[model samples]
Target: MKIAPDVVRAFTPTGKLRASINTGNPILAAADATHGARGVSVDLARGFAQRLGVELELLVFDTAIKSVEAVTQEQADIGFFAIDPKRGEGIHFTAAYVLIEGCYAVRNDSPIQANEQVDRPGTRVVVGKGSAYDLFLTRELKQATILRAPSSQAVVEMFLDQGAEVAAGVKQQLEADVLPLGNLRLLPGRFMVIQQAMGCPRSRGAEAAAALASYVEEMKRSGFVAEALQRHGITGAAVAPAA
Candidate 1:
């Protein structure tokens, strides 16, 4: 695919391509030994900058909400995000490059054994504020009340602290979060699967969005995305289907 000058410009208005990196989601990104961000999202951003022939700069944040907010506020040019309709108000997403499972965790003695059993009345679910799971569950869950934690890493602690019935988030995160307590168990199946995509501010115009969508599709077809996951030793997430 030939890269357009306008599309390159849209994604790199600051001369350098600024990518908002969310380290909160370890499946997508994490801190390297040097304390710099590295993972699937970071590798994808570097590839994007290489294609654009621009310098790449990472804007690090501890949570996806902060990362998405940075892109929407134009603090950064683009970001990796879950393709959610609520976030679409100020952002336009390209074809999803990855898919991650979202799960629900509850104390072993709790009544919630299946994914479908989590939304009953009087059940309180804890999630990271502004996370993809938070947004998804907020819309889909009518009876269960949601409690916001400071970040995804804090959801388990918050859930235990508040004695909430369930903790919901990325599957890997739920598992890691439950380890210390050693008493919580994930539901048998995932409640949702989040589509991870690259997004630019809507203000950048459709040309930018189209260009990115094309890039993501090309990356998928050429195995760039799958290879990146393997190289990073990332699991529990898979390349998203053709968009």
Candidate 2:
């Protein structure tokens, strides 16, 4: 079936929303490039389009920062990123649909097991630029020397390469790839709890935000949201009640 251009353009100038996918994260990877549109985010976007009786188009970007810029520049209707209040000035966020725990990735043999260990002098913590993890580490770990990487994967790589004592990112991503690297282990506690949300251009107004918010609520109530998470091996991240 042909999707209506008007429906597709609801979030973008050209009737297409560019969805950003993190190839480094397995769950998001499954939703975008790896699964060829079969991943959870893709499914959610499709559901959003279907519920609105519109056609949807997906545009993929390599990084979350790029994705946020896409929406801010009006090149895409919406994008997904970990929700942070600091980013609110640049875009409108729908009700968050997923909860993620931000934690540290350490070498497997490292003695660091708790948050306290991360605060000790000489601890080198790596984090991605502009990520929620970066913000958390910057504010919370007073004594550690924080190293900023360009991307989540790069932070993990830096830790593995011995550039830093720890890397910080979402728990699921660490569990999927970083933990198995033999030298890496996720610390016991989360540094910050993050809610993953959809972002729209700030200029879109309250009505568009309400429509997206309502659609997310419907998806959660219908059990589709949970199913999507489960299909992607994302556990414990609950869909929040729509605003």
Candidate 3:
């Protein structure tokens, strides 16, 4: 894994690897009182910086779209994102290094008990604004009215606030949100599985993107990705298969 000098420059034009971290997705990153941000994304950023032979500067964001914007605008060198075609326009994504499930949750009194029941004419689904689920359900769900919250962490709360029929997001997130409230329950299965990957600005050149893709593959193959997930106490997310 010898990194070329030009490839290093592509990731560290400012002599520091600026990794855009989004805390909106708790599975990827979260704000910690002891530290500014911590999660699997932070560990991966640190690992990438170590390999690039540069200092690491984490640019914290509260939403996926914001994080994507930082990389796409070239303000940051790399970012963690759920791969989506709309975002592929400005960024080059590696094969997913992590896979997380997306599911629906609803009030116990609600009649919805299965994934298929969520797309009916009267059902209103609340999802995070500009998230993978937001983009996904927008395209996949034809009848359900889509409502957006400020962030993924806020989706369930927003759903409750609006008295929406359903809440949609990461399964872990939905579980964490509905656990304390006795009234909400998750649907039988997931609506989608998110392919979370590292990405760089497309302007960084194919060589740079390829180098990143290779780095992620190595991380997966060497068990670094799996170990990180365990270390973070993150469950319901699986390390993706090698390229």
Candidate 4:
């Protein structure tokens, strides 16, 4: 069913459901501003609103935890982030449309040249708190000391400032901007596969969930998904079928 534009519930300036953006990438920021919102998350929310015939409201938060909280508390309808199964308990996730890889980023001068190099004792890795990379490090890299930051930028900053031996997060994001402090390098191997999806409150019923899922499938099949990625200059990655 095509979502009618008029049937979507209107959100007040301070509405119940707010859309959030990570704010670390320029593309995300531009997407938000394209629709007079604030980030890619907001743009995607607007797209959903248009598809479903609903009005959208935008919410800006500094961290992913806050974004997730907005949805859990019913302050927002959904959040956009890399998907992790462990996070499933806190909210419901639509099928994943983007695949990201978690890997280590180190300065060119750093001795670590590969993913295996990071597992050695005494290596300090910086990761954003509550991020997929953080969870991966906690569970997979037991031997390394992990430093938690509030955002991906903070993690990148730590690496740039030489605060840690490694910075771990989405490879695409890490490679987006130039690092003036030093050349950034991705470890030779991936730590985990990250599937980014839209997350809604788990309290919603199956019917609503299915409707959202079907909409995502339609976007994929109709080429809207590929177009969005390309519009953002996100090449070299395949848009997977909605998970």
Tens digits of lDDT, candidate 2, 1-243: 233444345655554445554444444545344545555667777767665555677766556676677777777776677776666887888777777788777877788888777888898888877776776677777888988778776778777676677888878877766746676777887878787777677887766676676666677788887788887777746676655
Order of models, best TM-score first: 3, 1, 2, 4
Clashing pairs in 3: none
Q: Candidate 4: TM-score? A: 0.83
Q: Show where candidate 1 strays beyond 4 Å.
A: 33-35
Model 2 TM-score (2 dp)? 0.85
Query: In the order shown, what is each candidate's alpha-carbon RMSD?
Result: 1.2, 3.4, 0.9, 3.5
**Candidate 3 lDDT over residue span 169-192, tens digit each:** 999888988999988888887999
Candidate 2 regions with alpha-carbon error over 4 angstroms = 1-12, 29-36, 241-243
Candidate 4 residue-wise lDDT, 107-126, digit = tens = 78888877888887888888
lDDT of each: 0.91, 0.70, 0.93, 0.67
Give the alpha carbon lDDT tens digit for every residue of 171-201 in model 1. 9888887877789888887888899999999
List the candidates ranked by lDDT, beginning with the highest. 3, 1, 2, 4
Model 4 stretches with alpha carbons more than 4 Å out? 2-17, 25-40, 160-162
List clashing residue pairs in candidate 2. Answer: 9-15, 11-77, 30-39, 31-39, 108-183
Taking all chains together, each candidate's TM-score versus the true structure is 0.96, 0.85, 0.98, 0.83
Q: Which candidate wins on TM-score?
A: 3
lDDT of 3 at 181: 92
**Winner on TM-score (3 vs 4):** 3
